[model samples]
Target chain A: MEELLAEVVNVLVVIVEACGAAVIIIGAVWAFARFAWVGFRQRTTAAFVPVRLTLGRFLALGLEFQLASDVLRTAVAPSWEELGQLAAVAAIRTALNYFLSKEIAEERRQVAAEQDHHEVTSTDHRGSGV
Target chain B: MSAVAEVTRLAALGTGLAAVVAGALALVVTRRPLPALAVLLDLLLAAGLLRLAGDPDWQGIVTAAAIVALRHLIGVGLRAGGRAWTGPRPPAASAQEKSAL
Candidate 1:
Protein backbone atom coordinates (compact mmCIF):
# COMPACT_ATOMS: atom_id res chain seq x y z
CA MET A 1 0.00 0.00 0.00
CA GLU A 2 2.84 2.39 0.78
CA GLU A 3 4.48 1.67 -2.54
CA LEU A 4 1.19 2.19 -4.33
CA LEU A 5 0.64 5.53 -2.60
CA ALA A 6 4.08 6.75 -3.57
CA GLU A 7 3.50 5.75 -7.17
CA VAL A 8 0.20 7.58 -7.29
CA VAL A 9 1.74 10.70 -5.78
CA ASN A 10 4.62 10.56 -8.24
CA VAL A 11 2.18 10.45 -11.09
CA LEU A 12 0.20 13.29 -9.59
CA VAL A 13 3.33 15.43 -9.41
CA VAL A 14 4.14 14.84 -13.05
CA ILE A 15 0.61 15.70 -14.10
CA VAL A 16 0.51 18.86 -12.04
CA GLU A 17 3.87 19.95 -13.35
CA ALA A 18 2.75 19.34 -16.89
CA CYS A 19 -0.32 21.47 -16.33
CA GLY A 20 1.89 24.26 -15.11
CA ALA A 21 4.12 23.99 -18.17
CA ALA A 22 1.11 23.97 -20.43
CA VAL A 23 -0.22 27.14 -18.84
CA ILE A 24 3.09 28.89 -19.40
CA ILE A 25 3.30 27.80 -23.02
CA ILE A 26 -0.24 28.89 -23.77
CA GLY A 27 0.24 32.23 -22.04
CA ALA A 28 3.53 32.95 -23.80
CA VAL A 29 2.12 32.12 -27.18
CA TRP A 30 -0.99 34.17 -26.61
CA ALA A 31 0.96 37.16 -25.36
CA PHE A 32 3.38 37.04 -28.27
CA ALA A 33 0.60 36.79 -30.79
CA ARG A 34 -1.23 39.73 -29.26
CA PHE A 35 1.94 41.77 -29.08
CA ALA A 36 2.73 41.17 -32.72
CA TRP A 37 -0.80 41.87 -33.83
CA VAL A 38 -1.16 45.05 -31.79
CA GLY A 39 2.30 46.30 -32.70
CA PHE A 40 1.50 46.02 -36.37
CA ARG A 41 -2.01 47.43 -36.06
CA GLN A 42 -1.43 50.51 -33.91
CA ARG A 43 2.28 51.01 -34.40
CA THR A 44 3.48 53.53 -31.79
CA THR A 45 0.05 54.37 -30.45
CA ALA A 46 -0.75 50.88 -29.20
CA ALA A 47 -1.19 50.13 -25.52
CA PHE A 48 0.85 47.08 -24.66
CA VAL A 49 0.06 47.47 -21.00
CA PRO A 50 -3.06 45.34 -21.25
CA VAL A 51 -1.19 42.62 -23.09
CA ARG A 52 1.52 42.52 -20.50
CA LEU A 53 -1.09 42.42 -17.77
CA THR A 54 -2.74 39.43 -19.37
CA LEU A 55 0.57 37.65 -19.63
CA GLY A 56 1.30 38.44 -16.02
CA ARG A 57 -1.99 36.91 -14.94
CA PHE A 58 -1.27 33.76 -16.90
CA LEU A 59 2.22 33.45 -15.45
CA ALA A 60 0.93 33.87 -11.94
CA LEU A 61 -1.57 31.11 -12.51
CA GLY A 62 1.14 28.87 -13.91
CA LEU A 63 3.39 29.52 -10.97
CA GLU A 64 0.60 28.50 -8.62
CA PHE A 65 0.35 25.17 -10.41
CA GLN A 66 4.11 24.69 -10.29
CA LEU A 67 4.14 25.41 -6.56
CA ALA A 68 1.36 22.92 -6.04
CA SER A 69 3.38 20.27 -7.80
CA ASP A 70 6.35 21.05 -5.59
CA VAL A 71 4.24 20.48 -2.54
CA LEU A 72 2.95 17.22 -3.98
CA ARG A 73 6.51 16.10 -4.54
CA THR A 74 7.15 16.05 -0.82
CA ALA A 75 4.60 13.31 -0.44
CA VAL A 76 6.77 10.77 -2.25
CA ALA A 77 10.27 11.99 -1.47
CA PRO A 78 11.64 9.39 0.99
CA SER A 79 15.30 10.38 1.02
CA TRP A 80 16.79 13.29 2.92
CA GLU A 81 18.74 14.43 -0.14
CA GLU A 82 15.62 14.46 -2.29
CA LEU A 83 13.71 16.31 0.37
CA GLY A 84 16.43 18.91 0.66
CA GLN A 85 16.37 19.48 -3.06
CA LEU A 86 12.61 19.74 -3.03
CA ALA A 87 12.75 22.21 -0.16
CA ALA A 88 15.19 24.43 -1.99
CA VAL A 89 13.16 24.27 -5.16
CA ALA A 90 9.96 25.03 -3.26
CA ALA A 91 11.56 27.98 -1.50
CA ILE A 92 12.66 29.57 -4.75
CA ARG A 93 9.27 29.04 -6.31
CA THR A 94 7.46 30.44 -3.29
CA ALA A 95 9.56 33.57 -3.37
CA LEU A 96 8.88 34.00 -7.05
CA ASN A 97 5.17 33.45 -6.58
CA TYR A 98 5.04 36.12 -3.94
CA PHE A 99 6.85 38.63 -6.11
CA LEU A 100 4.73 37.84 -9.13
CA SER A 101 1.55 38.32 -7.17
CA LYS A 102 2.70 41.63 -5.80
CA GLU A 103 3.75 42.96 -9.19
CA ILE A 104 0.49 41.89 -10.77
CA ALA A 105 -1.46 43.77 -8.16
CA GLU A 106 0.66 46.87 -8.59
CA GLU A 107 0.39 46.82 -12.34
CA ARG A 108 -3.35 46.30 -12.22
CA ARG A 109 -3.71 49.32 -10.01
CA GLN A 110 -1.60 51.44 -12.34
CA VAL A 111 -3.59 50.35 -15.34
CA ALA A 112 -6.82 51.24 -13.62
CA ALA A 113 -5.48 54.64 -12.64
CA GLU A 114 -4.35 55.34 -16.18
CA GLN A 115 -7.75 54.40 -17.53
CA ASP A 116 -9.46 56.59 -15.01
CA HIS A 117 -7.27 59.52 -15.97
CA HIS A 118 -7.97 58.96 -19.61
CA GLU A 119 -11.68 58.85 -19.06
CA VAL A 120 -11.71 62.00 -16.97
CA THR A 121 -9.69 63.91 -19.51
CA SER A 122 -11.89 62.80 -22.39
CA THR A 123 -14.95 63.80 -20.47
CA ASP A 124 -13.49 67.22 -19.77
CA HIS A 125 -12.65 67.65 -23.40
CA ARG A 126 -16.21 66.81 -24.37
CA GLY A 127 -17.51 69.30 -21.85
CA SER A 128 -15.32 72.05 -23.36
CA GLY A 129 -16.07 70.98 -26.96
CA VAL A 130 -12.46 70.18 -27.74
CA MET B 1 12.88 12.16 -15.43
CA SER B 2 16.01 13.32 -17.19
CA ALA B 3 14.12 13.37 -20.43
CA VAL B 4 11.39 15.40 -18.79
CA ALA B 5 13.92 17.84 -17.45
CA GLU B 6 15.59 18.14 -20.82
CA VAL B 7 12.28 18.88 -22.49
CA THR B 8 11.37 21.46 -19.88
CA ARG B 9 14.76 23.13 -20.24
CA LEU B 10 14.27 23.31 -23.97
CA ALA B 11 10.83 24.79 -23.49
CA ALA B 12 12.30 27.35 -21.15
CA LEU B 13 14.83 28.32 -23.80
CA GLY B 14 12.06 28.79 -26.32
CA THR B 15 10.12 30.95 -23.87
CA GLY B 16 13.21 33.09 -23.28
CA LEU B 17 13.61 33.63 -27.00
CA ALA B 18 9.96 34.59 -27.29
CA ALA B 19 10.50 37.08 -24.48
CA VAL B 20 13.30 38.74 -26.44
CA VAL B 21 11.05 39.19 -29.42
CA ALA B 22 8.20 40.50 -27.31
CA GLY B 23 10.50 42.89 -25.49
CA ALA B 24 11.87 44.27 -28.72
CA LEU B 25 8.38 44.72 -30.08
CA ALA B 26 7.34 46.51 -26.88
CA LEU B 27 10.31 48.85 -27.24
CA VAL B 28 9.24 49.74 -30.75
CA VAL B 29 5.64 50.22 -29.76
CA THR B 30 6.18 52.28 -26.60
CA ARG B 31 9.50 54.00 -27.39
CA ARG B 32 10.29 53.45 -23.72
CA PRO B 33 13.35 51.45 -22.82
CA LEU B 34 12.47 50.82 -19.19
CA PRO B 35 9.02 49.39 -19.89
CA ALA B 36 10.52 47.13 -22.50
CA LEU B 37 13.14 46.01 -20.05
CA ALA B 38 10.42 45.22 -17.53
CA VAL B 39 8.57 43.11 -20.08
CA LEU B 40 11.69 41.21 -21.00
CA LEU B 41 12.60 40.56 -17.40
CA ASP B 42 9.08 39.48 -16.53
CA LEU B 43 8.94 36.93 -19.31
CA LEU B 44 12.42 35.70 -18.49
CA LEU B 45 11.29 35.23 -14.91
CA ALA B 46 8.48 33.08 -16.16
CA ALA B 47 10.93 31.04 -18.18
CA GLY B 48 13.21 30.61 -15.19
CA LEU B 49 10.32 29.40 -13.05
CA LEU B 50 9.32 26.93 -15.73
CA ARG B 51 12.86 25.63 -15.84
CA LEU B 52 12.78 25.12 -12.13
CA ALA B 53 9.91 22.71 -12.56
CA GLY B 54 10.54 18.95 -12.86
CA ASP B 55 13.48 17.36 -10.99
CA PRO B 56 16.34 19.82 -10.84
CA ASP B 57 19.81 19.60 -9.35
CA TRP B 58 21.58 22.01 -7.03
CA GLN B 59 22.93 23.89 -10.03
CA GLY B 60 19.47 24.38 -11.48
CA ILE B 61 18.10 25.59 -8.18
CA VAL B 62 20.93 28.08 -7.80
CA THR B 63 20.42 29.42 -11.30
CA ALA B 64 16.70 29.88 -10.74
CA ALA B 65 17.41 31.68 -7.48
CA ALA B 66 19.80 34.00 -9.28
CA ILE B 67 17.20 34.76 -11.91
CA VAL B 68 14.64 35.53 -9.23
CA ALA B 69 17.05 37.79 -7.38
CA LEU B 70 18.04 39.64 -10.53
CA ARG B 71 14.39 40.12 -11.39
CA HIS B 72 13.66 41.63 -7.97
CA LEU B 73 16.65 43.97 -8.11
CA ILE B 74 15.86 45.17 -11.60
CA GLY B 75 12.20 45.68 -10.73
CA VAL B 76 13.02 47.91 -7.80
CA GLY B 77 15.45 49.87 -9.92
CA LEU B 78 12.89 50.34 -12.66
CA ARG B 79 10.28 51.61 -10.23
CA ALA B 80 12.69 54.16 -8.79
CA GLY B 81 13.85 55.21 -12.22
CA GLY B 82 10.31 55.50 -13.57
CA ARG B 83 9.31 57.82 -10.77
CA ALA B 84 12.39 59.97 -11.14
CA TRP B 85 12.15 60.04 -14.89
CA THR B 86 8.49 61.02 -15.06
CA GLY B 87 8.58 63.45 -12.09
CA PRO B 88 5.42 65.57 -12.29
CA ARG B 89 4.19 65.81 -15.84
CA PRO B 90 1.99 68.86 -16.46
CA PRO B 91 -1.59 67.65 -16.88
CA ALA B 92 -2.43 70.17 -19.58
CA ALA B 93 0.59 69.27 -21.69
CA SER B 94 -0.12 65.56 -21.49
CA ALA B 95 -3.74 66.19 -22.44
CA GLN B 96 -2.64 68.17 -25.45
CA GLU B 97 -0.27 65.43 -26.47
CA LYS B 98 -3.03 62.86 -26.23
CA SER B 99 -5.35 65.05 -28.24
CA ALA B 100 -2.70 65.43 -30.90
CA LEU B 101 -2.17 61.69 -30.99
Candidate 2:
Protein backbone atom coordinates (compact mmCIF):
# COMPACT_ATOMS: atom_id res chain seq x y z
CA MET A 1 0.00 0.00 0.00
CA GLU A 2 2.79 2.39 0.81
CA GLU A 3 4.49 1.70 -2.47
CA LEU A 4 1.24 2.14 -4.32
CA LEU A 5 0.69 5.46 -2.65
CA ALA A 6 4.19 6.65 -3.48
CA GLU A 7 3.68 5.71 -7.10
CA VAL A 8 0.42 7.63 -7.18
CA VAL A 9 2.04 10.65 -5.62
CA ASN A 10 4.91 10.56 -8.02
CA VAL A 11 2.56 10.33 -10.97
CA LEU A 12 0.52 13.22 -9.69
CA VAL A 13 3.60 15.34 -9.23
CA VAL A 14 4.77 14.57 -12.72
CA ILE A 15 1.42 15.43 -14.21
CA VAL A 16 1.22 18.72 -12.33
CA GLU A 17 4.74 19.71 -13.22
CA ALA A 18 4.11 18.86 -16.86
CA CYS A 19 0.92 20.89 -16.95
CA GLY A 20 2.65 23.84 -15.34
CA ALA A 21 5.37 23.76 -17.96
CA ALA A 22 2.85 23.45 -20.76
CA VAL A 23 0.90 26.43 -19.51
CA ILE A 24 3.98 28.58 -19.32
CA ILE A 25 5.02 27.63 -22.85
CA ILE A 26 1.59 28.19 -24.35
CA GLY A 27 1.01 31.44 -22.50
CA ALA A 28 4.39 32.77 -23.55
CA VAL A 29 3.80 31.94 -27.20
CA TRP A 30 0.33 33.41 -27.25
CA ALA A 31 1.49 36.54 -25.53
CA PHE A 32 4.36 36.93 -27.94
CA ALA A 33 2.10 36.56 -30.97
CA ARG A 34 -0.33 39.12 -29.64
CA PHE A 35 2.49 41.50 -28.80
CA ALA A 36 3.97 41.15 -32.26
CA TRP A 37 0.65 41.81 -33.89
CA VAL A 38 0.18 44.93 -31.85
CA GLY A 39 3.70 46.06 -32.56
CA PHE A 40 3.23 45.54 -36.28
CA ARG A 41 0.09 47.62 -36.28
CA GLN A 42 1.55 50.53 -34.34
CA ARG A 43 5.17 51.17 -33.61
CA THR A 44 4.72 53.85 -30.97
CA THR A 45 5.39 53.36 -27.29
CA ALA A 46 1.78 54.28 -26.62
CA ALA A 47 0.66 51.51 -28.96
CA PHE A 48 2.60 48.99 -26.91
CA VAL A 49 0.48 49.43 -23.79
CA PRO A 50 -1.89 46.62 -24.63
CA VAL A 51 0.93 44.35 -25.54
CA ARG A 52 2.90 45.07 -22.38
CA LEU A 53 -0.14 44.75 -20.18
CA THR A 54 -1.28 41.52 -21.76
CA LEU A 55 2.13 39.95 -21.85
CA GLY A 56 2.98 41.01 -18.33
CA ARG A 57 -0.26 39.49 -17.09
CA PHE A 58 0.38 36.21 -18.86
CA LEU A 59 3.95 36.01 -17.67
CA ALA A 60 2.97 36.79 -14.12
CA LEU A 61 0.44 33.99 -14.12
CA GLY A 62 2.87 31.55 -15.63
CA LEU A 63 5.43 32.40 -13.02
CA GLU A 64 2.93 31.79 -10.25
CA PHE A 65 2.13 28.33 -11.61
CA GLN A 66 5.79 27.58 -11.93
CA LEU A 67 6.33 28.64 -8.35
CA ALA A 68 3.44 26.50 -7.13
CA SER A 69 4.84 23.49 -8.91
CA ASP A 70 8.21 24.09 -7.33
CA VAL A 71 6.63 24.19 -3.92
CA LEU A 72 4.76 20.97 -4.56
CA ARG A 73 7.81 19.19 -5.89
CA THR A 74 9.71 19.98 -2.74
CA ALA A 75 6.90 19.58 -0.28
CA VAL A 76 6.91 15.82 0.16
CA ALA A 77 10.61 15.14 0.59
CA PRO A 78 12.76 18.23 0.58
CA SER A 79 16.47 17.80 0.91
CA TRP A 80 18.71 20.71 1.75
CA GLU A 81 19.64 21.13 -1.90
CA GLU A 82 16.02 21.06 -3.01
CA LEU A 83 15.06 23.55 -0.37
CA GLY A 84 17.85 25.85 -1.42
CA GLN A 85 16.79 25.60 -5.04
CA LEU A 86 13.18 26.33 -4.15
CA ALA A 87 14.19 29.39 -2.20
CA ALA A 88 16.19 30.76 -5.10
CA VAL A 89 13.41 30.12 -7.61
CA ALA A 90 10.81 31.68 -5.37
CA ALA A 91 12.88 34.79 -4.80
CA ILE A 92 13.57 35.33 -8.48
CA ARG A 93 9.97 34.82 -9.48
CA THR A 94 8.70 37.07 -6.73
CA ALA A 95 11.00 39.85 -7.83
CA LEU A 96 9.93 39.49 -11.45
CA ASN A 97 6.30 39.62 -10.46
CA TYR A 98 6.86 42.76 -8.44
CA PHE A 99 8.53 44.66 -11.24
CA LEU A 100 6.11 43.50 -13.89
CA SER A 101 3.21 44.56 -11.74
CA LYS A 102 4.81 47.94 -11.15
CA GLU A 103 5.31 48.49 -14.84
CA ILE A 104 1.76 47.45 -15.63
CA ALA A 105 0.39 49.84 -13.06
CA GLU A 106 2.44 52.70 -14.45
CA GLU A 107 1.25 52.00 -17.96
CA ARG A 108 -2.35 51.84 -16.82
CA ARG A 109 -1.99 55.18 -15.13
CA GLN A 110 -0.49 56.75 -18.23
CA VAL A 111 -3.26 55.39 -20.40
CA ALA A 112 -5.94 56.65 -18.06
CA ALA A 113 -4.33 60.05 -17.83
CA GLU A 114 -4.08 60.31 -21.60
CA GLN A 115 -7.71 59.36 -22.03
CA ASP A 116 -8.79 61.91 -19.48
CA HIS A 117 -6.74 64.62 -21.13
CA HIS A 118 -8.20 63.74 -24.50
CA GLU A 119 -11.71 63.93 -23.13
CA VAL A 120 -11.08 67.30 -21.54
CA THR A 121 -9.57 68.74 -24.71
CA SER A 122 -12.40 67.46 -26.82
CA THR A 123 -14.90 68.98 -24.42
CA ASP A 124 -13.08 72.31 -24.56
CA HIS A 125 -13.06 72.30 -28.35
CA ARG A 126 -16.76 71.53 -28.47
CA GLY A 127 -17.52 74.33 -26.02
CA SER A 128 -15.48 76.75 -28.12
CA GLY A 129 -17.25 75.66 -31.32
CA VAL A 130 -13.83 74.99 -32.84
CA MET B 1 4.84 8.42 -0.01
CA SER B 2 1.95 8.72 2.39
CA ALA B 3 -1.76 9.09 1.65
CA VAL B 4 -1.64 12.69 2.70
CA ALA B 5 1.26 13.36 0.38
CA GLU B 6 -0.58 11.71 -2.47
CA VAL B 7 -3.64 13.82 -1.80
CA THR B 8 -1.58 16.97 -1.71
CA ARG B 9 0.05 16.15 -5.01
CA LEU B 10 -3.32 15.42 -6.58
CA ALA B 11 -4.75 18.70 -5.39
CA ALA B 12 -1.80 20.63 -6.75
CA LEU B 13 -2.21 18.92 -10.12
CA GLY B 14 -5.89 19.67 -10.25
CA THR B 15 -5.49 23.31 -9.36
CA GLY B 16 -2.53 23.67 -11.68
CA LEU B 17 -4.60 22.37 -14.57
CA ALA B 18 -7.43 24.72 -13.74
CA ALA B 19 -5.10 27.70 -13.65
CA VAL B 20 -3.66 26.79 -17.03
CA VAL B 21 -7.05 26.47 -18.70
CA ALA B 22 -8.31 29.69 -17.16
CA GLY B 23 -5.18 31.48 -18.33
CA ALA B 24 -5.61 30.18 -21.88
CA LEU B 25 -9.22 31.28 -22.02
CA ALA B 26 -8.29 34.71 -20.74
CA LEU B 27 -5.59 35.11 -23.35
CA VAL B 28 -7.43 33.71 -26.38
CA VAL B 29 -11.18 33.53 -26.16
CA THR B 30 -12.16 36.22 -23.70
CA ARG B 31 -9.29 38.68 -23.93
CA ARG B 32 -10.03 39.57 -20.33
CA PRO B 33 -6.97 38.78 -18.33
CA LEU B 34 -7.70 40.37 -14.96
CA PRO B 35 -10.17 37.79 -13.75
CA ALA B 36 -7.94 35.03 -14.97
CA LEU B 37 -5.05 36.61 -13.15
CA ALA B 38 -7.14 36.63 -10.00
CA VAL B 39 -7.92 32.97 -10.53
CA LEU B 40 -4.26 32.19 -10.80
CA LEU B 41 -3.54 33.96 -7.54
CA ASP B 42 -6.37 32.03 -5.94
CA LEU B 43 -4.75 28.86 -7.17
CA LEU B 44 -1.60 29.83 -5.35
CA LEU B 45 -3.57 29.91 -2.16
CA ALA B 46 -5.00 26.51 -2.96
CA ALA B 47 -1.52 25.19 -3.64
CA GLY B 48 -0.39 26.48 -0.30
CA LEU B 49 -3.19 24.58 1.39
CA LEU B 50 -2.17 21.46 -0.45
CA ARG B 51 1.38 21.94 0.74
CA LEU B 52 0.14 21.83 4.30
CA ALA B 53 -1.38 18.47 3.56
CA GLY B 54 2.02 16.96 3.02
CA ASP B 55 4.77 18.10 5.43
CA PRO B 56 3.91 20.74 7.96
CA ASP B 57 6.39 23.19 6.52
CA TRP B 58 5.33 26.72 7.39
CA GLN B 59 7.87 28.36 5.18
CA GLY B 60 6.52 27.21 1.80
CA ILE B 61 2.87 27.60 2.61
CA VAL B 62 3.42 30.98 4.18
CA THR B 63 5.33 32.22 1.21
CA ALA B 64 2.60 31.19 -1.20
CA ALA B 65 -0.09 32.81 0.89
CA ALA B 66 1.95 35.99 1.23
CA ILE B 67 2.40 36.23 -2.53
CA VAL B 68 -1.30 35.89 -3.12
CA ALA B 69 -2.11 38.52 -0.53
CA LEU B 70 0.53 40.87 -1.84
CA ARG B 71 -0.91 40.60 -5.32
CA HIS B 72 -4.35 41.57 -4.10
CA LEU B 73 -2.92 44.51 -2.22
CA ILE B 74 -1.09 45.69 -5.27
CA GLY B 75 -4.20 45.38 -7.40
CA VAL B 76 -6.15 47.51 -4.97
CA GLY B 77 -3.44 50.14 -4.97
CA LEU B 78 -3.41 50.29 -8.76
CA ARG B 79 -7.15 50.71 -8.95
CA ALA B 80 -6.95 53.52 -6.47
CA GLY B 81 -4.28 55.19 -8.53
CA GLY B 82 -6.44 54.94 -11.63
CA ARG B 83 -9.38 56.51 -9.87
CA ALA B 84 -7.20 59.34 -8.62
CA TRP B 85 -5.90 60.02 -12.09
CA THR B 86 -9.40 60.34 -13.58
CA GLY B 87 -11.07 62.06 -10.67
CA PRO B 88 -10.31 65.70 -11.30
CA ARG B 89 -11.91 66.34 -14.67
CA PRO B 90 -14.40 69.17 -14.85
CA PRO B 91 -17.81 68.64 -16.41
CA ALA B 92 -18.31 70.01 -19.89
CA ALA B 93 -20.48 73.02 -20.59
CA SER B 94 -21.85 74.29 -23.90
CA ALA B 95 -20.45 77.49 -25.42
CA GLN B 96 -23.80 79.21 -25.19
CA GLU B 97 -24.15 78.24 -21.55
CA LYS B 98 -20.64 79.39 -20.72
CA SER B 99 -21.21 82.78 -22.44
CA ALA B 100 -24.55 83.27 -20.66
CA LEU B 101 -23.03 82.45 -17.29
Chain B TM-score, one value per candidate, order as shown: 0.79, 0.57
Model 2 C-alpha lDDT per residue in residues B14-91, reported as the tens digit of each score? 756655654454445335455445445544433443443333344655665576568657666755765776476554
Can you write out model 1's per-residue Cα lDDT over A3-113, one digit (the tens) per residue?
A: 999999988888888899889878888887887888778765326778888888898888899889988888888899999999898888788778878887998888788
Top TM-score: which candidate number? 1
lDDT of 1: 0.84
Model 2 lDDT tens row, A1-130: 8666657766676665555545544554454455445445543435445654665576567566656665666545437865765565566567656765786687688779899989999999999995
lDDT of 2 at A26: 51
lDDT string, candidate 1, B1-101, tens digits: 66657777888899899889988988888787887887788788878877888788899889999988998999999988877776898899899999999
- The local distance difference test score of each candidate is 0.84, 0.57
- List DockQ, one per candidate, in order: 0.53, 0.04
- Off-target runs (Cα >4 Å) in candidate 2 are A1-9, B1-101
Minimal lDDT window, size 10, model 1 chain B: B1-10
User: What level of docking quality does candidate 1 show?
Assistant: medium
Top candidate (DockQ): 1
TM-score of each: 0.88, 0.50
